[model samples]
Target chain A: MAKISVYRFLSAGCNGCDVEILECLVPRYKLADLGIEVVERPEEANVLILTGGVNVKGKEELLKTYETINPPKIVIAVGNCALTKEIFDKGYPMVGPPDQIIPVNYYVPGCPPRPQAIVKAVADILGVKIEEKEDYWLAPEGFRGKHEFDREKCMGCGTCAQVCTADAIDVIDGPDKRIVRVNYGHCSFCAVCQDECPTQAIRLTREYHLVTNNRQTTMVSNEVDLLSCSVCGGTFIPEKQIDWALKRITTEKVPAYSEFSNEILSAMKICMVCRRSIKNIREAKRLLTRLSEKVRGF
Target chain B: MPETVYIGPYRPQLVEPERFELLVEGNIIIDARLELGYMHRGIEKLFTTRTYAQNIALAERICGICSGIHTLCYAQTVERLMGIDVPERAKYLRCIYMELERLHSHYLWFGILAHSLHEHEAFLKIMGERERVQDLLEYLTGNRMNYLINTIGGVRRDITPEKAEKIRRTLKELKPLSDYIMSLLDDNGAFTKKTKGVGVLPRERALDVGAVGPTLRGSGIASDIRKEDPYAAYDKLDFQVIVERDGDVRAKALVRARETYESMKIIEQALDNLPPGDIVAKPGEPKVGEEVGRTEAPRGELVYYIRSNGTNIPERVKVRTPSYANNFAILEMLKGERLENARAVIESIDPCFACTDRVTIVDAKTGRRRIIALR
Candidate 1:
């Protein structure tokens, strides 16, 4: 078998992916040991490895480099930016994902995919088997890897979506269900979502090998049941969210609030709009004002 | 007769997309012009669109090598705008991370410089040592490149006793290897001979051009943002600002090589006197005002100026990266340099084109820049 020559083309990114690609050459990963050479020019290369999102300038470079590479060339897009444009997609200068610019054979996903993951991609490209070492698949402790969403634990408060730096998490409030979709293709894996999660539903698990040929393989979505307004029959909030709130109310020994917890819970069944119109109801209004006072105290 | 040579829009030596046009007569370069904007993603404009929390990630992405410093500077700036006091422990943690980043960045620069000089053995050895530092960073803050430990008010992560122990142990192991590498620079080997008198940036000229970090220090300037401004735990910690007198490629290498020791020293001090408290403060809203945040990134002084509209998002954000300042002085250094030494000289300053080409409105009258699209 001939030695594999890889040509790295840097696009418009933070250069995190490039650093990881270079990191593969370190003695630990031994990209060189695997009979791979990082050639200086595209014309001298068999595989073209591109890192970063495609901006106008990067797109030009990408197309020019792709054309320069000789026949039987392989193009591997490394990092989230290359696959889905990640956080930089909204930037003014960004051209969409690199795939829209060039034909990518393999997509290595991560904010910047782990060095080992990149090594795996190159090995897979050449149809060479990787020599597994001890702790080969283990990411470091506290490693921010793939995101895990727990449906049972999720209350659909949208805190993960709100605090997401990559804008990777999207919350869709449907009639019967609140769908929270996490696109790993756009995720930076900074774990701000994990940090700000109120119910600890979102976590980055220790599974670093996120490389895929299909873009849809990177998306994980969870759906939560939404409770409808009793009067208006409109979906207001996730049913589990209300249950979590009620559980919190019951656990905390707010004597005044605990005594009238039933009344408050019953009033909470109607949506905010319906509750506004029903504010004139004597019993409900009295309970609401009392509940509001107790809420501030708690 | 003068000849023309183009280095890149794509070159292995250039990690980012950049081009160098050199006009040469025989072996010496008569004129050199650098072409940029290939790596620009309009990060400053993007900052305005994202909220303060999201902007932290944006700031980190400006330059991957010196990523932590950007977040630290941006976080400090927003904290000042909101008048939030970060916890003492968080400050120490921030200091620790900054120093570790400096070590990693310097090691990377050293490896690249070694590789460029055809010192493949040294490059591999240095990179191996760098991976250890990166491992320590990964253990401390999850990821290797963009740590993302910094938040608006304080740091998001804390260094436990085990992580602190690992940092100390790793630095202890690295000290001897780094010393050997520094000694190699001290030697009369091919590496030292090739770099000794090449790409000299005079102290006076460096000062005039407002060069920062190792690029300025290598020219014998004793100034460092950590010492002068005293941000984070630097005011509390003790470490000398390493300076070299030569102002050549070798001097710049020496400055960075020696500074790794100073960085290790600072980290040790911060760790030994680690304060006990919460790692973050309750963040407050930013006031409608303008403020600046500055810090010593691995490459040089990084400044982030911002204006708030009294909202979650900033009205405007302007970044003055170290590479942006250091880039101007390169042409001065390149004027009389040998054509072969051109790449070495440019790499000496560790110019981060990604940091330099954020946004530049060249069209004056219309103030509308054309966006090029591929067919």
Candidate 2:
């Protein structure tokens, strides 16, 4: 009677976190021995477990549920959606982060954190002994590694960043250089970068030891010097990228490519915008010549 | 005269956000009106901004329960468009994960079904078995939920001989538990009393309203994408397309329970006949074209339509999820049933709203300006 109770709500989420949360209550895990119970009624719950990000509609409902729960309540935000609001972040449905609606006291982050993470969260909130799962039973061994960077080989074309679906790879523009930063924390270890890397520069070595909280500490970055456009003198692609492209294009010989002059080679060094502008000017000149020919006929 | 009861977009017992206004006379529901768009995340619109590889992660997030199949369908669709052939070994790897995912998902649904019926012991037992499945999956693929296994060309991870042996051992351990669970479902008079003849959607109505996966299979329709289209080395595996005659909650339960056994068998076959070769075939940049990918999700048949326009990013990505078809069929199943049966009927179809509602009818504003997944 009058024990600690939990009321779990999913704002607008994928069922992953919610299912994992449900997994903790299984007979194997048995969260009830800790004197915490998942109550159906919000009024009875002291721990409100939010499994999703708060959207516009969820903001109102979350607040309503938050208010209904009694005082001295602990709001534990489970999953990345609740902590970071990444599910529909900046989408039309999202109003703000979970903290904006109701203050979150604790956070358990993952696409969906393992069930132990959730149990630990519940226990931590309840002030109980947090039992961590044995590493062998939980995290699998084999082929688990963080992304590695080869500074000499990276052309800084941002292909890794572009190909990254996890949004782990970031192409940071510096005043003098371009940086390809790979965040190990967010990396899905899908190896798409290795597959998509044009230069075979970024690779995955079997090393899973580095785990850190600081974003900088976990970041594996490579920087390259920027190249100025031949036409506009604007900061174009990286110098390494230009060199790499030149080599790749030249090596894959087209019979017509053997006739390249210095002027043509220099024209190839123009930035994409300048290249487009040059093509437009050539079109305009042809149009003017066609008009003059019409005038001559007249 | 029928009275009206607006069930929820908000309620204590409800799992997801869905508003159902029911017209009931003496707790017997006559008609139902569904109100959607609580949080349509606009995932399809976001797809155009990301590269092919990036969308795999995005697709996995579509729904937690069947996240594997989303990647499977989307990858297959893009692969189809690009004319890239998946290696035989990779196909087997893909099948292994898909089956494991199916087992995990069905276990999840079964536990929820038990909970909905207030069978707490049964729920706990089923969830325990589910945890073991999750552990095995985690062993095979690094993460538990979104394995991130499938790629546009082939799969990312390969199952080694040691891993295969462990998987076989796990399956052996799981079989008895599966048998025990099937017996419990078949024998439990209390659960049967509540579920029998409850929320019956006949064969005609199931097909008429476009029910797919286990919901259709529960109604004795043996329509499975794995057998029909045979994606991901499923053609090599010999397993029955589990179907039940009754179109009620019990039939749905039987279909899912038996389907779990079939999944375990497929995994067994896949692991035994595990091939050797490259997991992925690297293809050139996708040309301008459109293609469709269909696969059987834990709930039903999932379809992904992808269009490319010569660039790395897709031109348009439309996901027609199994839940999209199965969710609508619930409306047909809900009519003239008691108010209490709504939860059972809805859960029977396993409504994956995140996958279902991809259309954004309008737009609004968020207070934050920072983009989430954009790099």
Each candidate's root-mean-square deviation in Å? 5.4, 9.5
Model 1, position B346, has a per-residue lDDT of: 79
> Runs in model 1 with CA error above 4 Å?
A253-255, A278-284, A290-298, B353-375
* Shift in Å, residue B341, candidate 2: 2.6
| Model 2 C-alpha lDDT per residue in residues A52-97, reported as the tens digit of each score | 7666676788888899997677777777677555635545576656
What's the i-RMS of each model? 2.7, 3.6
Deviation in Å, model 2, residue B110 alpha carbon: 0.8
Worst 10 residues of 1 chain A by lDDT: A247-256
Clashing pairs in 2: A165-B54, B213-B300
* Candidate 2 lDDT tens digits, B295-356: 98988888899989989899999998887787777778888887667777777887764211
